[model samples]
Target: MTDGDEQVSGPAGGSGAQPADPPVTGLAAPNGGASPRRRGPLWTALALVLALLACGVPGVLLLGLVGDAAGRSAVGRKDDPATAAARRLGVRMTAQLDRQASALLGGDRTGFLAVAESAARPDLTRRYAALRALRVTVWRPVADGAPAAVDGRPGEWRLAVTVDYCFVAPDCTPSTVEIGTRWRLVGEEPRLVAVEESQAKPAGTRPWEVSDLAVAVGERTLVATTPALRAKLPRLLAQAEAAAKVADRYAVSGTPPDRYLVFYAGQAEWQRWYGGGRPKWTAGYAVGVGGGHHDVVLNAQSVSPSGMGELLRHELAHAASLPAEGYSDRSNWWLVEGLAEYAGADGQPVNRHEGLAEVRKLVRGGWDGRFDSLAPADDATDDRVGGAYGVGYLAVRHLVDRYGEQRVLDFFRAVVHEHRSLDDAADQVFGDPWPALHDECVDYLRAIAG
Candidate 1:
């Protein structure tokens, strides 16, 4: 197995090598359309991973907004002429920026041209066209970091804008990105002069930039630049199909809509998408976009041969069960991930067994973490996180082993579709509360591991 840093603590795990932290950002929006709220630990870890890459600082969300610019004036103190001019210009630019955003969302090339300078029209048109082709919609273009008046030119200003990209499907969650923009006064109006879009890909590159090639196997679409890599599509498609079947057996609301787009790339491309070098143990990730589709990327360059299929199944399970709208709470991390591992365990991959063993070692080694709180430990030692996976798998494995797969599946369905807490779901499905079930898992593990 390719084992540089990929192991399971959360999202990514294996044996011998430490598990890489999985990308927490791309899974389907847990909460589809609910009011915005703090995401659970899964997303919190993903944000940390992204921040680690972009700024070499961990714990910040992806491309942290430069800084809140609303209160600070860029030009000078409140009494300065430059400040007044900048304030007026800032208001006008904000309006024009809104118009520009509308044009981009509507795919109105002329509308974009009307707002952009002549020198920028062609590029803007091309960019808008590409975004439209990708089926990306910009919901809001809010100014984030403060706007600054250029030192010597009263006609120039720079603003940091964060645009949220809506999914083509109403059920999918939107992705937000921070971009730095420069606006210049042309003739009587302000127009876009330049955009330092951090999220913008090179020409001809797709959003993931893993590959430009594409193919379809059943409901899955595989994209890559190499024929050899593309050949692997059949295997992934098979795994996805199996994952769906396994997931359906346990599903409550039926399978989610499947975009089924998979991308094959090296570690470099994977890191690029997250905006930084991922944890050395990182291997691959699945990102859920609009339209009930998930874009899966494999670190083709890193995952071991023995692990490739297991990784695919695990991620596919996430794709299969992702809710169309809001998110699951942090307390249910074990349920969300335990089920993924369960669905993917039919192959008898060693990683699962190793993770299970890791938990035993932790218990023997004096660790006291509980399965209920098992999540990706972005900062914890590998052993602790690996134990999380180990114990998580055991918890689900015990439920299925004792309660029969149907009741456990029902439990998952209730938590996801019916929005039941883990305790509620357990009580409803098994007539036992969470504490009892947790105790059962403890007993089962002790009996077997002893």
Candidate 2:
């Protein structure tokens, strides 16, 4: 149950005494032919006459040319039969999607399944049930671009569909993900046959799509666990709700998500679900779905009940503060991880003694005293990673001590959410340039290290 075992997907990093999980894995045209003709002597003579007239053209010939131009314009204005058919199919698919969305929102399983092919219905049924269990409030799937015709498949088409969904009602913002879908025309009706990963750009798999879930809805949280963990739902839900309250205190940007969605992943799910390939040491992580909404995933087998609270607080803080558009600059890793560490350590010690010891070690080893340099390397040992998390916590604590919590939060929002430059954000929030602020933080670290 090490504190640093949790990771956050996107720009912001993790917090606590345990090793940090690795960064969240970010998820991301034609030819022709021709022919020739032959002509007789009379036709050749007529063609020669026409060619001569066209060079300086007779008035009637010019008028004929104008008429031909007008005809070409008319043809260009009208869609070809193939194009017209595709348009009609697009309309039908749009209507079908609307109906499916309505059915999902209204909990009409039959209606939702009406447009699905028999082969796809079983998987869709499972998905619908999972969404219902998680209390999904919104499920809108819109065609991203025009449906593309599948090669050599006359009645079948492929489309990129973007789906928007939300678990909590009214106050919850919809998070979006894209899927590649295959559809076929069954007597002029569009039938969904498959929903799959897009080869061009892959999206993270939702928890419900991974396995059967047992859900527990709390006042400020929704915990979805596997059937094996159903008996512990009450305990997990309670821990999440408590953590949400602590995290709410740091939600300075705006109202926190209507309900913090948490997923408790079983052993198999822990590896395959929600942006996979996390280090084995990772006990939990938070991933942004879209629209400023992030969902937390806990490795059910790895994290203990007692350790869940700190991890939840750290992740929920990310859900509360990370922008809809995630940050990419790794230089801001310290502030990103530090803020979470700060919020997570609320009412608890800042892991001070261990953090200071690490800082002292770095200083004595000819460190440059740059906070940016303190983040753990990708292959860093657990002890080294743990030390990085410790130093990050102390750095944030220093900010809170010098400037009040609100000011620190304002600075974080400006840089991370608002995407302002560090110098500009620091000067705006703290009345000093970033370099000055950086030097001050370094001085504070050195003093504490000593």
* Candidate with maximal lDDT: 2
TM-score of 1: 0.59
* C-alpha TM-score for every candidate: 0.59, 0.78
lDDT of 2 by residue, 214-241 (tens): 9999899999888888998998889889
Kindly report which residue stretches of model 1 are placed more than 4 angstroms away from their true locations once superposed.
1-154, 158-180, 196-255, 261-265, 286-297, 322-331, 346-356, 379-384, 404-406, 413-424
Reference-based lDDT, residue 242, model 1: 57
Candidate 2 ranges beyond 4 A from true positions: 1-76, 152-155, 197-203, 351-367, 446-450
User: On residues 271-322, what C-alpha lDDT tens digit does candidate 1 reach at each position?
Assistant: 5543434444445554433333345556777676667666666666665665
Top TM-score: which candidate number?
2
